[model samples]
Target: MAEIEVYTERYEREHGHKPVGRRFWSFTIVSPIATAKDHFLHTEQAMTYDKALEKAMEVAIKRRSERIIVEP
Candidate 1:
């Protein structure tokens, strides 16, 4: 289970569409954690893209001490 954050107003303003239904976006944020697997799975079920973005950043900062490897 993933914790999803929701930023409805922000999303609506950006896309000109209210999140009355389903909305999605592909976003990549820096994560200090080695992997997102063990962490809470933040999915659409949990929150919206905007919220997810914020949470991701927060998680990254909180787990900054953890070693992470980025792949190309």
Candidate 2:
């Protein structure tokens, strides 16, 4: 897997709380829905710490939004 580094501020906007330091990741994924002309659509998500991760995961599916994962 390829790993990308990002800032806490960006992570916070996607997630909620501002991250401490450089703890953001980005993964490029190809979209299957796009056609030949459109190609793939890029999607991004951010992760926070453990407490936030748990809550984010639990409600993510229902909420239909990307969330963050953090250390416990």
Judging by lDDT against the true structure, name the best candidate.
Answer: 1
lDDT of 1 by residue, 28-69 (tens): 333445465544433455455456555555655565523221
In terms of TM-score, the best-performing candidate is 1
Candidate RMSDs in Å, in order, are 9.4, 11.2
What's the true lDDT of residue 33 in model 1?
51
- Provide the TM-score for each candidate, comma-separated: 0.33, 0.26
lDDT score, residue 6, model 1?
A: 33
Q: Residue 39 deviation, candidate 1, in Å?
A: 7.5
Q: Which residue runs of candidate 1 sit more than 4 Å off their true CA positions?
A: 1-36, 39-41, 44-46, 65-72
Clashing pairs in 1: 2-41, 2-42, 3-42, 4-47, 5-51
